[model samples]
Target: MALLEVKNLGISFGGLRAVNNFNIQIQEGELYGLIGPNGAGKTTLFNLLTGVYKPGEGSIFLDGKNITSYKTIDVNKAGIARTFQNIRLFKQLSVLDNVKVGLHNQYHYSTLEGIFRLPRYFQIEKQMNEKAMELLKVFNLDGYSHYKASNLPYGQQRKLEIARALATNPKLLLLDEPAAGMNPNETAELMETIQFVQKEFHMTILLIEHDMKLVAGICEKLTVLNFGEVLISGKTSDVLNDPKVITAYLGE
Candidate 1:
């Protein structure tokens, strides 16, 4: 069964259709790309998948379970986690604390235990600390664990966002423009990081990226969106070479 599936899904904003008749199926461990020009509704699609927006028609399934229109938090708990196109870190929190927030989904103690610093709280806290640090180390952010999340360089901050999302232990990870604002060298590093994350975590990823180079390097399959509709979906090379994509997306 596919890890993620959407069938005939669509949403309209007032009289305008923002996403119309979208359908996609992604297998476990696949790295897929959603690419388009600005306003192609790529992020809107992410919002829908993450439950920020409910679809007006059709169904969404994760691992064969219908999750259409589930509340945002509930959708998150159901094995889907995503990073935003705009970085959304807890700026006031320490880098470690930011990651721990994601870990909260998996490890928890009662509120009383937290308030009183009970033994169970400490136990869970220790486990989360170890795990969060392990994730930070993967992103090479371990040495800055105590620093404020807002203080990291832009590239490291982007990495931290991904690490935190992974801390949710999600079955599917969605990255929205992971290479946005990156330099050529930073984009190169990001490609390696994404590849490493997929292999190390055995993760399934679906990302919305404008950087064709980054998309080409990592995504095996590609979906092109144009003006809120799918232009094409197929093997990366084939989709990139499609005449429709050349005319509508890349421009002849």
Candidate 2:
């Protein structure tokens, strides 16, 4: 069964349909790309999947279970996590703390236990810290665990966001324009890091990226959107070479 399935999904703001009849099916451990021009509704679709906005039409299924209108926290609990186009780290918090906060949903200790510092609370805290550190190590950010999130270079901050999302133990990870600001070297490293995280965590990834080279390099399948609808969906080489995709990128 597919890990995630979006069937004829759509959403609109007033009379303006931002996403129209969008659909995708992602199997476990698959790495896929969603590409589109600005205002093509890529982020709006992400919002629908992540529960930031309710879909005006269609349904979403995860692990064969319907989750079309679930709450945001409910969606997270159902094994979906995402990073935004804009970095959303807690700037003042230590990198480790920022990741630890992501574990809050998974942590089982009660509020009373936390306030009282019960033995179970301490035990859970220890486990969370260890897991957070392990994630940092995987992303090669262990040395910066104690650093303030805002103080890290822009690239490291992006890595931290991925690490934090991993803390949710998701089955599917949605990365929105993870390479927005970086030199070629940094973007190259991020490509490898993304692949590594998918393999190491055994997670499916659906990424939205503008960099054709980056998308073509990493994504096994590509979906192109324009003006809120799919232009093409196929192998990276095929979709990238499509006349419609070319026209969308470079108008006549």
Over the stretch 1-252, how does candidate 2's per-residue lDDT look in tens digits? 988888999887989989999888888899999999999999998999989899999999999999999999999999899999999999999999999999988888999999999999999999999989998999899999999999999999999999999998898999999999988999999999999988888879999999888999999998999999999998889998889999999996
State how far residue 74 of model 2 sits from its true place (Å): 0.8
Name the best candidate (by lDDT): 1
lDDT of each: 0.94, 0.93
Query: TM-scores across all candidates?
Result: 0.98, 0.97
Estimate candidate 2's alpha-carbon lDDT, on a 0 to 1 scale: 0.93
| Angstrom error at residue 3, model 2 | 1.4
lDDT of 2 at 154: 97
- Candidate 2 — which pairs collide? none
Worst 10 residues of 1 by lDDT: 243-252
List, residue by residue over 187-234, the lDDT tens digit for candidate 1: 999999999999999999999998999998889999999988989999
